[model samples]
Target: MRIAILGATSQIAKDLILSFAAHSQHDLVLYARRPEVVSQWMNNIGLVDRYLVADFTAFSPAEHFDALLNFVGVGNPAQAAEMGASIFDVTLKYDDMALGYLHQHPDCRYIFLSSGAAYGASFDEPVNETTQASIAINNLQPQDWYGVAKLHAECRHRALAPLPIVDLRVFNYFSHTQDMEARFLITDIVRAIRDKTALKTSSDYIVRDYLHPADFYQLVRVLLAAPATNTALDCYSLAPIDKATLLTVMQDKFGLLYEIQHSGVAVNATGRKPNYFSKNKYPKEFGYYPSFSSINGICNEIEKYFMQDNLY
Candidate 1:
């Protein structure tokens, strides 16, 4: 299959690209805002000759593709906040680009990288297929914009029911390719271990299910091969890990030092989500099942990072 990947420079997209190159015969054409960076990365990883790198501006409907995966969006909370209201425009732009392509090639499958934030601000419990999105239309906030943008795209996809589009709502994703400087709980833990500095974290208990790249790739592959349908699916692992357990594991295996503070930890731009993952097993019907549990996946990827950096 020939696949066109938008925003191919993203960590998730890069990981998936590597997976496809290493494990499959699919031809990939990577489209990114900064194609040079992706080209350099491909060269560094010895994949320079294996794929084509093109600018997103060069994305044309004239090119035929079996599938199109849209990974274009802000990666971190800081980026999400910085992008602000423009998230809507950026999302709509790329989504419309893909929709236009789908119009030309109706048989092509589109896999959109959505987020659990699309479920809206409150996440007191894990989401399921039955869970409806909760949005405060009268009281919109900056944090709501990102999720709203993704939700809007999903809405548009569903409205175009004849098209083969699948929205994968990822709650939490961590991998060896993740930026170390990024402000995420697992990254903080990794930094603490790497720098031998004590981690100071808030006492706000939260549960997260970090999807492994392998599992994510499997989900995408499953969706690509599944019967055509216009729907959304929540990404999940074998199980989720709570903050307490995560901290304990990091401390034990990685020699991470951490102190819990009652305050001063920065809040997420997308609002507080005490339970950010999903319990939805809908993807199982499409023959997708995670091979790693949250802790196992975290350990596996972190170990790979350590090995790569000679930190172990």
Candidate 2:
């Protein structure tokens, strides 16, 4: 399988690239606005033939290449707000072009990295594919830029109906390569613990489910292999580990517990919050189960860290 990834710098992209590359049957082609911008990010994307420079900012399918996986998207609110004009052009217009390519190619399968915020946040319930979406921008306004942009993108992908699309409402996924300052609570907690003997968060850490990078890639690869899309089977949370468990794992792994603060109320996010996801269906369909969750991967990462220096 030859896979082409858009936004090669993305977390999902990095993981999927490595997964695709590791398989002798897969050949990956990476695309982004600038190769040099994320050359450091694509260290695992060694199998890619070249970094096809194309910007989602200007929805020009002619500018981008047709690949198996179109795993490029931005969910950062500040960034999306800044990219106001580009957001519409890329998410709506050009995104369709990419989908059309997938639809026509017969060989290409589109796997979009989306957010759970697309589920509409006001309703506090575990969401499944049955949940309805609120297409109103007003409903999504308070959800933050990242949520709004992602919902908009997901909506656009859905709108390009009559085409096969895989809109994965990915939850909190942490990777070793992302910027340390990003908003991921686990990464932030890890950073804080690394920064000082005592780890602290200004508020009781929000419970976010986590998915490991390896499992993420497997999920994507399996979905692509089967070419199931525009349906519940393709769209899913990467894999989940609830917040309490995540924090507990972190504390146990590092042996550092700190004065965690709390604002008292739930930290509301915009749109829907189906942050909880199950890999059961995906695993059943593809025979792949993620080897790690938040805690599962932490211990392994720690073990590998110590072993590198023969500390075992």
Candidate 3:
């Protein structure tokens, strides 16, 4: 299979490029905004045949691709600013290429990296592919701009479904490919622990599941190898998000302490477990139950990166 990957620079994207390039007998081509901005060895894990570069603002998919791993959405934080100017193109422009690429190569097996945001507000119950979308069309005015962008990307994938498209509304994923600049809580915690800083979290922590990079990659490989398998499980979580009360557990376990500011309101995220993701199919599909999820996998990265002298 000849594969083209857009936005091969994200932690998730970087991992996908490497994993696919390594295992599959496919000819791989990687693309990013700046040709060499991405680390040389990042996408070469599988030794892709080509590494093309182009700004998504000027994105145009190159021809002759058998499959596409479109993981191009950057969770820009500006969309929620009080006077935000909507620099959404820096993000939405990739949707242009993903849709166009699928249209151009009708036979291409396209995998659009959708998000758990598509579940919208139906989080009242366990979310499935059939759950009603929480947000209405174009009403993407959320503080978590990344979540909004993910919602938009999923919609685009839906528009191109007849073209062998596999849409995955993945939830929180943590791994080593993460950029130092990223503000994800797990990475932030790792950095704080490495540097020994106080972690200030909400009095009632937000409960979200986490997954290890390897497990996440395994799921991606299963989907890419079997693109026709529409088994769309709406969400993926490494740990049972139900126990997500506070990272104070993580903090205390790691010998770190912090302050918490609770909402002091009823029925809010004031130290409560939000939901749990159903994880049967993921195991059935990938043959690997995510053992090292958020509670463990995230800390694992810190252990690997920092525990050089038996610090754990």
> Judged by TM-score, which candidate is best?
1
Please give the ranking of all candidate structures by lDDT, highest first, separated by commas.
1, 3, 2
Query: lDDT tens digits, residues 226-280, model 1?
Result: 8989999999999999999999999999999999999877548898899999988
Q: Rate residue 266 of model 1 by lDDT.
A: 58
Q: For residues 1-312, what per-residue lDDT tens digits would candidate 2 score against the true structure?
A: 555667776656766666555654655566677666566554444533443434444433343333445555564433544564555456555466576666556445676666665554543545554666555665435345555666776766666655567766765666555454554455556555556556545543234556667767767666666645564332333345556666666677666566666543223333334344433254445655566656666555545444554533
Candidate 2 TM-score, true structure as reference: 0.74
> Model 1: runs farther than 4 Å from truth?
none
Off by over 4 Å in 3: 21-25, 39-62, 76-92, 122-126, 136-149, 227-232, 242-249, 263-273, 276-291, 307-312
- Looking at candidate 3, the ten consecutive residues that score lowest on lDDT are 264-273
RMSD of each: 0.8, 4.6, 4.9
lDDT of 3 by residue, 72-139 (tens): 65432221243232425655676666667767767777777766655555354556444565555575
Q: Rank the candidates by TM-score, best first.
A: 1, 3, 2
TM-score of each: 0.98, 0.74, 0.76
TM-score, model 3 to reference = 0.76
Supply the global lDDT for candidate 2.
Answer: 0.55
The per-model lDDT (C-alpha) reads 0.93, 0.55, 0.58
Score residue 24 of candidate 3 by CA lDDT.
64
Displacement of residue 1 (Cα, Å) in model 1 is 0.4
Q: Tell how far residue 36 is off in model 2, in angstroms.
A: 1.5
